[model samples]
Target: MTNISRSNYDPEVEESEYDRLERRWTEQLSELRVTQAGTQIMMGFLLTLSFQPSFETISLFERNLYLSLVITATLATVLAIAPVSFHRILFGHPGAKARVVSITQVLLRLTLILVALVLSGTVALIFNMVLGTTAGIIGGICAVVTITTIWIALPMTVLRKLR
Candidate 1:
């Protein structure tokens, strides 16, 4: 069998640790794309609610709740999309790893919050339109609980285990 030279196999122009971080950031951006799409769609739908015929018929409290959820969705969409643009602007900076990691953590938190808001909003909206106060409250609670479990609890548990 022919043997390869170590220097040839592992080139002198090897990637620095920062290049590894940049690669990881690229991967993280790809993953965030899916979440960005979903939240943007949800925010779009939330925006259209004001023009709907039924929107005027809802109680003041429900209207306020709907508005709050829409704001959350909008914020979430922005946060989710921040990292991509942030990297583009800060690509060559020496502090890329620190910035990227900070942005990633913030995006994750925003995503979880947005997930809860969107889920609760959708559920509460449906119940408000169909089954009224009791059902809306119940549905919102259920949605929050689900988000906390899958988004917050599960990730925290896995991270804790890793540590």
Candidate 2:
């Protein structure tokens, strides 16, 4: 057996630029799969809510909030799946994978933002219907803060530490 020098040896395998881009694309697609599932479920829930008999009893503000959430959820669903369309369109072209991956990253961020909004708004709407307006607003704020902390702040902190 040949002995490998520890200082000269890279434990991590080096990937070519093309291979790196492909790996990034694959990872992005995996993330999209998770995001898409949740977005589609939320979209379906929002779509069916309007068909429910109790939906008619909602206050005007609640109705408006529900409508906004439905729109936001729909947007999130679209954004979550948009990367696939982009990849398909850009397929087989030289250097297109990089572009596809970049676009996917942007779309993923936007999708997450819209999903966060839908979640917070849904919570607020439910609280308003069950409790009161103040409670609803508070619930929405709390949801926003929690999501921001977990999704954005934590990532930023980790990145800073790495740097």
Candidate 3:
């Protein structure tokens, strides 16, 4: 009937702080690699849109949306790569690995938000161009909802359950 305390310590998989940090950094790098590739590709596509012959024919609103998407995508790409730059600049400094990991986690979250916006905007733009304004708005809203549910809500729910 006595209280028992539970600890996360697992002797079978012992890891030093430095080793844990290294593993986290490695995993973060892998995630960033994937995100960077997608963001760059999206940026490239957005950049090429203006050169198309039909680009000049779009409404002002569409043009503004496209510009915003381009800017957001660029920001996302920069954030996705910021972790690597931070690590490079802080390399070999004491406690730098932990700092890099913390910064990387923040950057990654921001990048994901920007990526979601870019994706939703892209869908809106395409729908607006092909269908109508109402369709475009609906598509964008649906995209946002779906992304939020999958990316943010799902993780939060799992974390809450774990806690």
Q: Highest lDDT: which candidate?
A: 3
- lDDT of candidate 3 at residue 90, scale 0 to 100: 99
Q: Could you tell me which residue pairs clash in candidate 3?
A: none
Output the lDDT of residue 85, model 1. 81
Query: Taking the candidates one at a time, how many backbone clashes does each contain?
Result: 0, 0, 0
What is the clash tally of candidate 3?
0
Least well predicted 10-residue stretch by lDDT in candidate 3: 1-10
For candidate 2, write residues 101-159 as lDDT tens digits: 99998999999999999999998988888899999999999999999999999999988
lDDT of each: 0.79, 0.91, 0.92
Q: Show pairs that collide, candidate 1.
A: none
How much is 25 displaced in model 2, in angstroms?
0.4
> What lDDT does candidate 2 reach at residue 21?
89
List candidate 2 segments past 4 Å from native.
1-13
Give the CA lDDT, 0 to 100, for residue 14 in model 2.
68
Ranking by TM-score: 2, 3, 1
